[model samples]
Target: MLQNWKKIMLLAIPSLISFATATLTGTVSLIMVGDLGFVVIAVVGVTNIIMYNAFAIFSGIGHTVNYLVAQNYGAGDMKKGIERTYLAFYMCIIFALLIALVGWTMSSELLRWIGGPKSGNLVNVGTEYLEIRFYAMSFGIISFAFHGFLRGIGSTTLSMVIALISNLIMIFLVYALTFGTLGFPNLGLRGTGLAILIGEAIQVAICAYVYFFVLNKRFATRILVRIKWPEFRLLAFESGKLGMQEFSLSLSMFIFTVFVARLGERALAANEIALNVMSFGFMPAFAFGATATILVGQYVGQGKAILGRRAGTDTAILGTIFLILLGTAEFFFAEQIARIYSNDVQVYELAAYLIKISAFLQIFDGLLNFFAGGLRGLGDTTFLLFISLAVSWLLFVPLSYLFIFVLGWGSLGAWLALYTFLAVFGLAVTFRFYRTDWSAVKLREASPH
Candidate 1:
């Protein structure tokens, strides 16, 4: 158990750092653009929610690839692992193009629907940002796929390094382009979008180098030379199912955000601040969740069902500990943290309240993330898909409506609904984890056609 804990932490901490860096990048954006006022902040927040919903579809491919690669590698099938990576890469390109085309064509309409004409400049700003950012989907998706591949092979440190460097470049470019510093144009929100694009493109380049030259040399694996149609179809089908799960979750959040937006710009901006701050505390759980997935998948692949279960248990323990400590800090410093994002007194006060709410829910949040990853790693995605859809759509959305609309609880009411959803979802997944025989599940056997 101790050794498993050590191993999980070794992989997970770097993953945590990578995820934290990504979260901080967005925090910096909010901080830098906070001066643009509540409307602009709200616009960025809405755009981010939409972007993530779209990206979640392709990100599912990365998660699926991670499970496949880790299982194959653990089973001493290096060639199969390499093949899975190539298939994921190809699928990523196709999906990226499709997602971009759809986003580009519908950005204006979507923003208008969310923000309405009364949103004034917010709609136009968000639309333009989405249109520009959609063009970077290919690069971002490719980078994510490579990150998943590396994580599966126990090279999370490489992914961390790439994420760190790429995010640093984004921060610098955002400052320069937003303020017309370093001989760049003062493009404001558009500059923020451009910086994200260039940064993702650089990450893609770095990942390509690592995948082709570094990893190839280290693992003695060859690049994509052939397509395996059967395996390709299976990967696509599994990823698509997982993608639908992600899409459902994102859609729920998007709907929730739309409700928040209806409360006005201040409410939306405050919600964004609260979410970002909550992300910091969530990072440890997120990392541990990814750790659970990799370790459990690999152990199950090696036919050690008990070891796979042990890995998940150990990860949940560690994640709970980390989140408890972080949540304590968040509870005490909620106001200060909120102040970092905006000078608006109302926004900060509301953000602080939401942060306190989030602080109390951290443990349940950790449980949900850790177990969800464990289930995914065990090739139990169907259950996760069903449960997530049920909770998000049936329970969460309705409760949110009742709290915010019917009862007039506003943001606090919306958050209370979120807390209830996470608590229920966490318990459900945890029960499933203990009760189910995940060891008998085989990815290849479960493959569609």
Candidate 2:
């Protein structure tokens, strides 16, 4: 127990720092944007969801990096691990460029496709934000990819320190540029976008210095400047698998947003607020899961199956307990949390209910996250993706629509469906982890071609 506790701390400390810095960025961005009114907040919210889905898909590839590199690092192949890191960085840059183009080209159409008539302001604001934010994509993706590399190498503290420094820069810029406090023009939401770009750029610069000059300098020579055709093909295929898995899981939420829109602008506003609040409260669980992914991957790579299993089990236990306590506090304090975002009676009331449901789901959410990361670390994402698809689409969507539309349960029913689906997913994933073939996976000495 003492050894397990020590290991958990070793892994979790960096994850917690990353989670905290990310949360701070979100909270500060929203609070500043809120000063412009709920409509601006709503616009920012929609933009966030769109960007999250896109960015997460790319960051999903980072997961593969984490799993692969951690295993290699533990197995005494740190140089090979660094080579993979080089591949990940280059791939991220190329993908980020492509995603930015797509976002710029499709910004307005996305709003229209979601079936909203009064979305002119939203489309306009969001498009500008997305375009400016596009420049940040390369930096963001590289930063996230290197983050996985560092975590994989069992350097979570370095990742944590980078996140803290990056977020501090982001927050300072958000204040200086958003409200024109430092003789800068007030760019409003656009300023928020610019701040993000600048912050991520700084992180990438710092990481490059660390990777090339500090940690494993061997990777500098091995960096894939002109992509190796065979290596690129294999890495791309693997990254695509990771990206698609992420898309399948998160697209359900994106689609669910469309459903919320049908409930009117007020409902959409409330849903967005509730989701952001949930992100804030659940940061620790995410941190724990990231820790589990790194630890499990590293141990498994080291040929320590028992240690890997123990890491997963112990971290899952800690994550579950943390969620239970935090959920209770959140459930009892929903109104207080909601008030921090808005004081509007209608928005507050609806958002408060959503928060209440989120609290109930946190336990299930924590479990699913814990096991899912473990499975990913084990290179078992295929099954996890299938499970998520079934639960999110087959179960959650239909049940939510039936409850909200057919049964007239409104937003409350939608919330219930989400919670129930996540719980079911948690159960399914946990069972599969015990009865599956994930334990057999081992890193290939030669890159897959």
Candidate 3:
């Protein structure tokens, strides 16, 4: 029991650090742009929401690589593990390229439609930032493959190092370019996008180097010399199912943001700041969830369902405790945190209120991630897909719309609707985790025709 706890924390902490650093990069970027006025902040925030949903959908597909690699590694099939990783990596690139192409051509129009006519400067700046950032999606998706593989094989420290080095450098580049300092062009929002592109390229280079040098040799994990159509189809089909689950959730939130957009630019800016603060709780919860997926998947591969359940439960508990503490801080220090993002009095006060509301739901938020990870380990993505679609479309979308548009509650209405959606979704996921029989859950065989 003690050993399991140690194992989980050791693997999870580094992942936590990796995500924490990534979130920090976002927070700092928002703060830096906060000085440019609220419109620019809204531009960046809206761009992120679009890209974030895109990433979540594809990263869901990428994460199936983790599911595959962990199971294969536990079953002592290193060759098969690498095969799936290679497949996922290629698939991510192909899918991301399509998205990039669409974003390059259509992002401006999309922003105009979402923000409505009054969006003015936001549409122009957002389109510029989003297009350049879209160019980096392939690189980021490739890194997702690497992280998925690393987490699968329990090599999380390497993942941490990569994210830390790349994003830290990204910060420097964005800062330099945003302000035209350090010999970099001051492109404002455009500079931030350019910096992210460069940062992603650096990240991909590191992933490829480490993969070819260290991991490939250590595990003798071979790459694809030829495409096996049957294997590709199987991998894509399974991952696509998972991607749909991810897409449904992201799509809902994307619409929710559109409703927020209806509230005006300054309100959007405050929401962005509040979200950055929320990431403090969200990222750690995500780390524990990732840890649960890896650990639970490993135990499942070993035919130890009870052990998998225990790992999932323990990690959820620990994550909940950490979030409760963080939530308290968010509630208490809400004003200070808001000040970190904006000096505008209205923006800061609204952001502080949003942060306080976010604190109330941290417990449910933690449970959501951990249990969802457990389900992923059990190869239960299809179930998740159905649940997400049902809740997101049927309950979340209408309620939020009603609250924001009809009730005249503004941002408060959006947050209120969000609180209800998450609580229901989180509880639903937790219930499924407990009631299901793990023995009945089947994973794919490593060696496929």
Candidate 4:
């Protein structure tokens, strides 16, 4: 038990660091742009939510890479793992091109669907921002895909290094370009978007180098030469299903954000601050969940179903404890944290209240985050996806609309709605984790190779 704990920590901490860098990048960017006022902050927040959901397709697809690579690694098929990793890269490129094409053409329509005319100007600004960022989707998606692939095969540290370096570059670029420092144009929100694009492009370059020169060197030259179409299709189908699950979750967030937008600009701005602060605390669970997926998948592959179950449960407990500490800090330091992003007294007050709600719900939040990951690792995505959709849309969104919009409870009500949803969903996922025989659904047939 002690040994397993140690192993999970070792893998998860770095993964957490990588995931945290993304939120940190956004937080710092928001703080810099906070001076632009509430609308700008709100716009960025909305854009972040949209961007995450947009990326969910790739992230969901990447799960296929993780499952396959981890399983292959455990089965002692290093060659098969490498082949799947390469295929994921190719598919990400293809998918990213499609995203760029569609997003560029449909940016206004999408924003209109979510934010309406009152937010139309903000949406326009965000669209321009997304346009610049979309150019790099291919690189970003491929980087993410390879990151999952490598991490699944127990090379999580490599992904961490790439993420850290990419985040540092984004920060520096944002400062340099947004402020017109270092001879770059001061693009503001657009500049921030540009920085994200360039940084992701750099990450893709790094991933390619590692995969082609480093990882490929470790495998045979023949495997490196081949791009197996049948295997690619198999992985893509599985990934597409997972991606749809991810899409549903992200889409739910999009809907919820739109609901907040409807509560007026102040509410929108407050939600942004509250969400960012909450992200800082929830990151550990995401990291731990990533580790659980890898470890659990590997265990299942190695025919050790009992070990996989134990790993999932143990990781969940550790994640809960870690989040509790974070939640406590957020509860006590809510005002201090809110002040970091907003000088408006009203925005600060509202954000603080929301953060308190979020802090109290951290344990529930962790359970939901890690359990979903654990279940995914065990190839239980069928149940996981349906549950996520049901909980987020049917329960969370409905309650949010009722309490915040209908009851006139404002930001407090919105937070309360989220808390309620997390509590219910978390418990259900926990029960499923304890009761389900996850290992029974292992990939019975090999992805065509």
Candidate 5:
């Protein structure tokens, strides 16, 4: 058990660091934009929320590459594995371009709707910032392809390296270009967009080079493989299901925020601060979940149902214990955590209170991620989708409406709604995993031409 836990941690840590790096860069970018004044900050913040939610949805589709590749590679079908990688890569590019086009054309209109009729400069500035940012997603999704391939093959180190490279460059470029320093042009908000575009382009070049190099040296697979569009139909369909499921998470957050926003600016701001505090642990739970996905997926592909089952069960145990420790730290240091984000007495006090509440979320969140990860390996996403839709909107949303508006619980009520949601949703996911036999599951592979 100790050795198994060690194995899981070894795989999990690099992914965790990689996630943390990406998030840290985003935080730094937000802070840099904040320096330009509050209006700029607000526009950028709203744009980020929209951008994040969209990316979350589409990236869910891209993860089809990871799921398909892991199973095929584990079953010793390298050709099919490589085939899926390319097909998914092509699919993501098409989707990225489609997203870019739609976002670009509708940028002004979307911002207008979001900001309302009276939103003048806010909508205009956001439209410009958001349009430019959409172009970056093309390269970002391309890198996701490389990441999925590497992760599917159980090599996570290079993904971390690529993440560091892209995000570190983004940090440097966003700083230089935003401030007119280091001979880089100061285009202000536009600079942030250009920086992301350049960083992701660099990411694509390096990721492409590394993927092929690894392919030749490690896997010894043919460098050139062909894909049939017809064969990719099933992959795309299944991936779209996953995309909707992932999108629901962001939708839930937005809905939850709306409910909180009604309580006024203080509640909203405090809620944001509390979320930032919560994120310190969220990334790790996600990392552990991804690790479980890779391991369990691989084992199931290899026809070792019993081993896969045990691995997932043990992973959930180990992940819960670690999160419990992290939650304890959050509980003890809630005040310090809230203070890091804001110093407003009422704001920080409310935020600190929310952080204490969020401490419970760490455990529930870990369970959701871990079990969900295991289920992803089983290609059980359709079932998970139904659960996300049913529990998130039906239970959580209404509960928030009841607690906040009717009971006048304010933000406290909303947090309780979220707390209730996570517990039920997390346990529901856990139950699905335990009750099912996943070993018999394997995805159909496309014939490499």
Candidate 6:
């Protein structure tokens, strides 16, 4: 167990740092925008939901690439791993174009549907933000692909370094562009979107350079010139299932946000603030989840199902410990954390309450993350898709509507619904993990054409 713990930690530490930094960068951007007012905060929050929803489709491809690359690398087939990476890259490009086109064309209509006509400036501001941000979709896809590949090949440290550098760049740009600092004109919320675009572009360039030159030389594999249609089809099919699951999850969250928006701008902004705080605790779980996926996939490829299961178990245990520590701190410091995101007394106080509520859910959240990730590594995406759709749509969404609309529970009610969903999801996925014969699961074997 100690050895397993150490192995997971080697991957988890860097993955945690990378994910945490990325989350913190977004939090800081929102914090800076918060100073503008609740309206701006609400607008940015809504815009982010739309952006992430689009990106979730690409995440399916990223996960598929991660799983296949890890398996191939573990099986001592670097060439096949490189081929899978190329396939993911092509898929990302095509998907990114589609997302950009749709997002730009329908930004206004989409925001209006969510916020209603009474939303006023929120729809306008959010639309502008989305249109400009849509151009950055390809950059985000490229960065995600490279990061997934790096994680698969056990170069998580490199990925961590890239994330840190990119986030630092984003922070600096957000300060300069949003506040008119360093001889720059104040661009406000639009500037925040621009900063993200620039940061993603920079990360892509760096990742491309490293993957094409440095890592290629080290691995003695040519990633740029490899293509396999059958492998690509297999990856696309797997990724499509994963992508649809992610899309459904994101759509449900967007619907939940819409419910909160109906309560008014104050509620929406407060909810966003609370969610950001919750994300801090979630970072460790997400990191460990990614680590479990990579390690489990690799170990299974090497015909060591026992080690794969042990890796996931150790990661979940470690993630739970981290979440408990973070959640405790969050519970104690909820007010301070909330205040960092908003100046309005009402918003901060409500956000604090929500954060405290979220603290109690962290352990279950860790379990869900690790178990779901482990299952994905074992090519169990179909089951995951079914469960996610069932929980998010059938249970969580309906309950949230009933609570907020019928029961008059407001934002608090919405969060209670979320808590119930996470608890159920965590338990269900964990049970599946424990009972499944993961060794029998198999991805399509890569073959040269």
What would the per-residue lDDT of candidate 1 be over residues 1-449, giving only the tens digit for each residue?
78877898899999999999999898998899888888888988988888888888778899898888888767878778888888888888887789779867988888888876466667667788888788767678888889988888878898899999999999999898877888999999899889999999999999988888887876665654487678887788779888888888889889999898889889999999999889887798789999988988888778776788888999999999999999999999999999988999999999999999899697888899899998888878889889989999999999999999999999999999988988999999999999987647664533444
lDDT of 5 at 353: 96
- Model 5, span 40-95: residue lDDT tens: 65466556666667787777655677777778777888777777777777778888
**Model 3 C-alpha RMSD to native:** 1.5
**Native-to-model Cα distance after best TM-score fit, residue 209 in candidate 3, in Å:** 0.7
Clashes of each: 0, 0, 0, 0, 0, 0
Tens-place lDDT per residue, model 2, 21-47, is 888788778877777777777777777
- Stretches of candidate 1 exceeding 4 Å from the true structure: 443-449
List ranges where model 3 is wrong by over 4 Å: 446-449
Q: Residue 328, candidate 5: how far off, in angstroms? A: 2.8
The C-alpha TM-scores of every prediction are: 0.97, 0.94, 0.97, 0.95, 0.90, 0.97
Whole-model Cα lDDT per candidate? 0.86, 0.78, 0.85, 0.81, 0.77, 0.87
TM-score of 6: 0.97
Per-residue error for 400 in candidate 5, Å, reads: 2.9
Better of 3 and 4 by lDDT: 3
Cα TM-score of candidate 4: 0.95
**C-alpha RMSD by candidate, in order:** 1.5, 2.2, 1.5, 2.0, 2.8, 1.6
Deviating ranges (above 4 Å) for candidate 2: 217-234, 437-441, 444-449
Error of 4 at 334 (Å): 0.6
lDDT ranking from best to worst?
A: 6, 1, 3, 4, 2, 5
lDDT of 3 by residue, 128-177 (tens): 88888888776898888888899999889999999999999999998999
Candidate 2, lDDT over the whole model? 0.78
